[model samples]
Target: MAGRVGVVAVAQTKFEEKKATEHTAELMYNVTREVMGQTGLEFKEDGTGIDATLAASYDLFSGPAGAYMFLGYVVGAYRREDERVLEDGSLAVYYGAMQILSGHVDTVLLVSYNKESSVGKNLIEWVGMDQIYQRRIGLDFVSAAGLQAMRYTTKYGITPEQCAKVVVKSHRNAANNPYAMCCDNITVEDVLRSTMLCDPIRVQEAKPTPVDGACAIILASEEKARKITDKPVWITGFGSCYDHHELGYRDLADCEALTTAAQRAYKMAGITNPLKTFDLAEISEQYAYQELLWSEGLGFCGKGEGGKLIDSGKTQMGGDLPINPSGGMLSGLPVCVAGMQRVAECVVQLRGEAGDRQVPGAKKAVAHGVDGPAGQLQCVITLEN
Candidate 1:
């Protein structure tokens, strides 16, 4: 907590089915310009504006060897230090915070983009898996998520109806989010009846059609943050963990990596009880069941009790601790940028800028993100206004 870092500004593009008109860099520039405009910062290299830049993108998904090739045009990385984070965009935020904490940078611009429509989503994800073990068997995120969902439900007695509620809630919350991709009114029955892509995982239960979008945020040191904005969402705590890469070697029903990451973040933030400490949560629930599974891992409920937690209505907008007021990943945020969008939503909520989805008087929040098969890698970030 010595060199505190705060989120000064955040911006995101509207999630769309296809962004054919604009290239990747163009999409990213839209978000970067918005954040820079809000903070009145220029893209200078004399340490007068952003001191560093961090970009997140997947080479396989972006159709380029070094995906960051066009990112420099938007983040203004002409002369200043800049790096590419190949993982989830949330990692870029994490790295930016570290740069500020290291006393080397006062302001860092973080951006991430994914154009799922530009490439075969499945084929791209397929290449990321173990070619010999997983890829040959046609293991993708959907099937892996189905395996995890089945294990979690069987262990906890969570019915498909309970999982459907997650989709219903996500769609409902998305109605108030302008950036959300799918905001149509939907019910649990609708979700249950939706096309079945995988067992216990209906089309509605899984993430909506992949969208093309970008997100940008500016992180600044305590001194610079105070000057940029009066309301700065401080990064109180953060941690990440990686589980076994081989799906067979791990228990899909449990998220030990997320649990350990949350525990480390909670301890660093001095949060003894996450359920009562944070006003709300923004989680990267790529699938409906993931919300329940991850909530348990985050200590919002006991293991095997995620179903009961959802039934309690405690995570609704007006509930004790709302989750995913921005509709979360389920609303069709791009994969790589989903986690950063969660962080941006939390920042908006904490700053009282989340117009329609704002939780009343939200003072603190927690955001979660994951990567790899079955969420093998997980990251947790705690924020305070």
Candidate 2:
């Protein structure tokens, strides 16, 4: 907390429907190799290279409780201090920053990825519920999200058309992101007319495909960061919170967890006004309606004003503050990796490396992610050039 934790390098693979040709280890190695190559750092334990390694992933998604052992070797963690963040990927960055800020490590490597296509043995979403309660009630993320969508939209007067606009914008923005999954142009009419999966939430409004991808980032303290790169992106602030697990306990219309987590990060970053404080935002939206709900939670607008925010085109690529210029989670990011992708995108943007989706003169950005049923858990990280 004294100096600063900075992200000196980052890399990610093109998110796609499947990566059957490559194993998960390959994904990890590819990104780790690229990121380390960018910084000229190795796994030397002599205090001159990466001091620790962190992997952001979920054991459930990988189908083995102790999978990190096999992964550790692939990411150059052989006999090195390697740990895993079982929640959303953004938290790994949070944990890595803390490691450096605590003076326990000078440099860290974070690799986050999950092949959604390989999760065939279990229903990752449904299995997340309690066995005796929610599971018996038959609730998966889609249906549960549907319940939230109806409650949020009805309570806030957010029209289904307004939610559809999110899908149109996501796909359109994905075109600018070469690492994005297969993207096709779509319209609000197209989203509204698409297959209705959960009443107001249409098929087109959800992540179009299960994607396999990996993202890697190298983090260092201020002293090492300056030596690694002239354009180091600093991790100025961070926060995470988990709400009540039971759907019955929460008000489906509002996400208090997201607001609390965001407020903590904003306070640390001295962000009194999110819309004016940051030039852009990368939010993890599993569904289109979530983008609206999360924007409000992030304090982009007043309560019940999320619908107006999206409808105004204020969150577009060329708007006052672009939201998801790199196509966000709705484009195809898997759950665990989605939040980390948001952070990686922010690093790219702040480094002036995001080619077509770049936000001009973007000195600041926020990356967000959520887990659990209906955003029960939330994470926020603020980054700056």
Tens digits of per-residue lDDT for model 1, 1-385:
5579999999999999998899888888899989999999887767779888888888777777776775576778776788888888878888889888989889999988989998888778778888888998999877888899989899889989889999989999999999999987899889988999888889898886669999999999999899999999999999899898888898899999999999999988899899999899999998999999999999999998889899999999899889999999888898989989899999999999999999989999999988877898899999999
**Model 1 whole-model lDDT (C-alpha atoms):** 0.89
Tens digits of per-residue lDDT for model 2 on 142-187?
7888999999999989998899888888888989999998467888
Per candidate, the number of residue pairs that clash is 0, 0
Candidate 2's C-alpha lDDT? 0.89
Q: Give lDDT per model, in order.
A: 0.89, 0.89
Weakest ten-residue segment in model 1 by summed lDDT: 66-75
Name model 1 segments beyond 4 Å from true.
Answer: none
